[model samples]
Target: MKGITLLAVSVFSTAFLSFTPLNKKYIIIDAGHGGSDAGAVYGQFSEKDISLNIAKEIHKINKSQDKYEVILTRDADISSSLPDRTILINNLNPEMVISLHVNKSPEKETPKHGFEVFIQNSEGSKKLADKISKKFSAQTIVERNLHILRETKAPAVLVELGFINNTQDRNYMTSEKGQKEIAQKFVEIINEY
Candidate 1:
């Protein structure tokens, strides 16, 4: 996590927005699971690592420009509980929360591999998910009561970036080209939102 810094450090208990003097438009990027919780794993790839890599790419891209003020829930490969993440995010009062994750299939023999975006019951959340999903040609805006989507107060999205169990998805998702492309799509989504 060297050279990685938070522009705005949030305080959790009181549940309020905090901003770096330089910027006011803020967003939180949550890199799914880390540490021992490998999320969806398949042979050479782990969802935690992949999510982090993509999140880092997003951070790097945002750092270079006077875009939105971005902050990641976990900057490194460290474990952070979903509840704690929810609490932190609720307190931050960001414009949105993008929780990066990888999708998996129960049966790898016939895998459904595609980018899927999940949204809570909120209309704004659904619209955001739809916009982003459409841009990536994703599966659809899935209305799911996922932990992050359900708990966070901000207009939140839980993006199943791609399926790790699928052959084609695995190759693209784990590659530098795919990660950067996806990261760029995220930036586009945020800016356009």
Candidate 2:
């Protein structure tokens, strides 16, 4: 009887260890465009590069935290199709997804600036966007039918960090300090989730 009980306990322990704990929340940080798809571009600044940097920064910061598991769609400069990204997101079934990007206005050096948070029609998506926008003191929270937002199974928000064409917006987004601050904001927000 003792031998049988010990064997059963060992099997249960092994099975529990093999599965992910329910207490930890999984979050996906999607770097918008990459490689051939350089999203919004202005001078030397590319949206793909900026978004990737921010995503990596967030992941790095989250590594120290025990309650959350942060994942990135692409860690390098490679183009990933919308469908592929969506599939990954759906498979992970994360608690939330944040897609990072830099925006560009049609006009040269356009004054349009500041961050914009785009969400899907779902209530959870809207709530997530509201939390992020409030953190940045952002005014624009638009409902968009973007591929990433529409296709992802989890609550997701697409954030346009800043306008690349605007001088102030461009400078802030490209600088290391700005990126760190942006990344820090996300870490803080994720803690709430």
TM-score, one value per model:
0.88, 0.88
Clashes of 2: 0
Kindly list the per-residue Cα lDDT of model 1 for residues 1-193, writing each as its tens digit.
3112222223342434432453477789999999889999999799999999999999888886666877899889887778778867876678899999998998847999899888999987988888887888988787898899999999999999889999998999899999999888888888887
* Residue 48 displacement (Å), model 2: 0.2
Q: Total clashes, candidate 1?
A: 0
User: Could you report the Cα RMSD, in angstroms, for every candidate shown?
Assistant: 4.9, 9.3
Question: Could you tell me the lDDT of residue 129 within candidate 1?
Answer: 86
Superposition error at 37 for model 2 (Å)? 0.4
Residue runs of model 2 more than 4 Å from their true location after superposition: 1-23
Worst 10 residues of 1 by lDDT: 1-10
Give model 2's TM-score versus the native structure: 0.88
